[model samples]
Target chain A: MCTMIAERASIQGSGKTENAWISIDSCDIYYDHPDHVDSEHAITLSFSNQLDPINSRISLEITPESAKEIIRKIKAALSKGDSLER
Target chain B: MKNYKTHDYEGLIAETIQFNSANGDSINAYFAKPLHKGKFPCVVLIHHLPGWDELYKEFTRKFAHHGYIAICPDLYFREGNGSPDDVAAEVRSKGGVSDEQVIEDISGAVDYISKLDISDGKIGLFGTCSGGRHAFLLGCSTDKFDAIVECWGGNVIMDESSTNEKQPVSPSSLTANFSGSLLGIFGNEDTSPNPKQVNEHERLLKAENKDFVFHRYDGAGHGFNYYDRPIYRQEQSVDSWVKIFDFLDNKLRS
Candidate 1:
């Protein structure tokens, strides 16, 4: 199974950074990037919403751990003051 | 303190009005107006899935108290309501009314407002639940609306298969075509519009370079705007009302 993470943040003031980590299905995606990244660069995790065989609905589930990791990356990007890649 | 009815709010007076829709289906609508009104900006209110009821009436009155002429047309004319439970049961049993019918009824209401001497021709749209979905669709289709507020609408993004199967209006597709400013208020606990759906909507809006605002209230469930409903969240409702008024005032007022 593949996991995805999407994070976005709007920061206020300077010299302060916020970190967030997100864990989903026992896999952790952490966001610890430096603060130099622009706030507009949101981290996105894209996947298909398709299911095979059974009639179970396909959904994208986000766990708090994964959210935290994405937030951490965002804060790191902001702190480093660099453009984010993806 | 004595319990006052919702209509007892200051600066509002409720009246029943009849309007003709594009399909020539006569629509019965409730009009809420300010006590001192002469050429005030108006709002064409659309009701949710179960159709027009007391909750929608109260909402119109509240909007009237805020100085806008709020007209709520009966979207479900075929199935009349005996009670709230009846409305809910009907909605669950019959799914949803056709989107084309909704747009026709809304257009009729807009026409009614345009012909009114007391209206300034500027109109905004607001609705909850299914009505919210209609508001978004109508707002996207018409340039007449200055502002639109949608609360907890569902199935915003539809798959190609679903569209082919049901032929329903896809709000996700409509977002890119929206020219008016939109305000979407959703409950954090609304499973219909999960975080993923919300994010998808945001992404579409951003990609299309559309102007919009989305607010998700924590600890609130679906139908938080209805004061008498079980899912009502008083604090969030109050806050959302404030934001709605501010948005309307800024956009609709000349």
Candidate 2:
């Protein structure tokens, strides 16, 4: 598609990066061209705090299959408390 | 190297320039012109949604090398400066630039070009993707240009459910207000301004008795002229570029 197929979904998680612990306030996920990934289209997700543009950014670009795998792994990790990785 | 023909000395000066729009908003733009002195036709090149990046600057230089003055305003200038991709991402997350503000900025650009000592009093307009839609919008909204070329413009037909909040009306709706000659290039595979939409556009223009030309290339999709993207169609882009230049020369020069 020419325009982004995007959605504003809420994410619950916090991660530390660049010597700062940034809480993700907003998340925008879309299926579109990935800047860093050399793919025509991919699942792009950005976890950010709208107020702090600099501190809160965890961008991920993954293939559809990879995204599904990540979802599966995440579910297993949360349920089992310890999940096996391939 | 490809033996490209040049009508003048292929020297140019390109740099970032600041210009105040009619709204008193100072914006940054990539300004380029031929180093050689005579008055030259001006081009107000609107950058695509992909942020005003290196490719656009290259286009500016290309025009300058071809003996024309060109300026591509950074539409994201109002937002704090950031990398092109980051700026684009931020703008998209914020729902993009407003159509009214964009129109005002474009008005300023046209005014700026008209006052330049090196200007030949002729201004050519060009844009692709979202910028392409803006070119068509400006064409109908004002008589500030001599020629306009819109390449694969999306959202001009306005899918209401998918329309961005910033753009309240479809450019197609204002077809009756269009002035000067317009040259539109599209891809048969594009869905935004698909073949059906293009047909309707032509029909409306004909009904209004406006002077415009439209062409659709097979085996090409949206952003086909974008050399760096996966959608690039080399043959069609080359053909389209030729058409754009010819249109400018025909309308602005003779």
Candidate 3:
């Protein structure tokens, strides 16, 4: 199915493309069909610089379980950083 | 099954052409047809949401092989040029293309094909996935098409919450207006138009007394005919193709 489900947000970061590291402007998150992944569907985190070409964007297609675990690890790491600062 | 004669000559011509779409915007399109001289039915192919990529080009040529003049317009042409996947991802992020714009582009294809001297003036619409949904919508919106082949079309029954400025109305709502013969192909395991949704779609069409036939395959999911994906089911795909050709023959050829 062509799920038109997607959400976008402006973000501040830099990501490396084949050319070089470019300033990323926005990100889109969606759970839909994968272009390369073998799975039927995957949660995709796509980072892009609006000022750059479409191909310059970076993307990660991961399973739902993988996405959840990554979120958990991210929160844990952030909590550890706060504790260390305190 | 009848086999081709040993001395039969088969030839095809395929090329990319640019034409004006909605709002007079020029866009790229692929056209394929048999080289032999004969009045042929035309098929306007609405490419799936994955964008107008290589697979659709192959599909256009396949129709040409089967003696139809086929044209597939690049709906994502206005989104800026890039690789098909890149452009598709961009369109996906932007909530897909607007239903109105797509209708105009496909209408442009119809106009282009209709003008050809070789055309028999009978046109059929074929599409899969979101394209299928569009095919259903176009068939209902106009009397131009003789047949519509909708394969695994999702969002034909869009809920109110799914409605956006792009796709504001559920196509199923126009079931009463559908006048063309329709052939729907679905996979039982698909979720978007899961069995329940497919049932509801059929119910709506039935209520309108529409002329349609639906084929549901067991053990197959969405895009079962896409050989590039792991979900491709060879047996189901072959059977569905047979059904499609048969349906088109009855609807457009007869």
TM-score of every model versus the real structure = 0.69, 0.88, 0.96
Q: What clash count goes with each model? A: 39, 0, 0
- Using lDDT as the measure, name the better of candidate 1 and candidate 3: 3
Q: Write the per-residue lDDT of candidate 3 for residues B1-254, one digit (tens) a residue.
A: 12358798888999999987856888999999999988999999999988999989999999988889999999999888888877888999888999999999999889989999999999999999999999999998999999999999999998898888999999988899998999999999998789999999999999999999999999998888987767789999999989988888888888
Error of 2 at B26 (Å): 0.6
Candidate 2 residue runs with Cα over 4 Å from true position: A14-23, A33-41, A54-56, A63-86, B1-8, B159-165
> What is the lDDT for B63 in model 2?
82
DockQ of each: 0.01, 0.32, 0.65
Candidate 2 chain A lDDT trough over 10 residues, lowest sum:
A32-41
lDDT of 3 at B74: 98
Assign candidate 3 its CAPRI class. medium
- As a whole number from 0 to 100, the lDDT of residue B193 in candidate 3 is 84
Model 2 chain B: weakest 10-residue lDDT segment is B1-10
iRMS, model 1 (angstroms): 17.2
Q: Evaluated against the true chain A, what TM-score does chain A of model 3 have?
A: 0.87
Model 2 residue pairs with clashes: none
Top-TM-score structure, candidate number: 3
